[model samples]
Target: MDFPETVRWTFAGLACLTLAALVREIRRLRRAEPGGRARVRWDAADQGAGLVLTVGGALGSLHLFGAGLVLTGVVLGGKAVRAVRARRRTTVGRPST
Candidate 1:
């Protein structure tokens, strides 16, 4: 089945957004003052705005652009959640004395 160009381009843009999100979150994750463990939060408004702008620029207002932006947002959001989960998992169930 052939996927719409909107969907395909959107998916690609979304992947790129996730990558950018990782870069941004990685910096924050490394810099965060750990109360217990470090968790990356990529849902920052700034990032969202950036996604909108990035996707918008990548795929103008051809309707597909909006879809691309939404996909990008989702990818970024998923990455954020996964990062936190990974941090939690790593910190949990350690061999205690």
Candidate 2:
């Protein structure tokens, strides 16, 4: 497949991930039971990861359109690292029970 197809699939996948994560987070927050700091931390981590995915997808798509090719691997590699960092932050912060 060409850059266009690759970019399209990447964008679609990012959208799906965002949609699913958002739905899950909303459901978690909507529950009557109070959520502890850990839950909140994980939620925030998820949001941060979503941000990276969104930005990476947008940039990759733009480059693919304007430049006729995208460094999708590098762009997404950085984004994956960012997502890992966010998860680390969520886990590192100690939460009271």
Estimate TM-scores for all models. Answer: 0.37, 0.40
Candidate 1 segments whose C-alpha is farther than 4 A from its true place: 41-97
Which candidate gets the maximum TM-score versus the true structure? 2
The weakest ten consecutive residues by lDDT in model 1 span: 36-45
RMSD of each: 9.9, 9.1
Q: Mind giving the per-residue lDDT tens digits that candidate 1 earns over 1-97?
A: 2456776687568748756885776677667777522234444444554555555555544454465557667767777787788888997888757
TM-score of 2: 0.40
* Candidate with best lDDT: 1
**lDDT, candidate 2, at 49:** 56
Write one digit per residue (lDDT tens) for candidate 2, span 2-92: 3465776677687677767767676666663663544554564555456455545655544333332233344456567767987899988
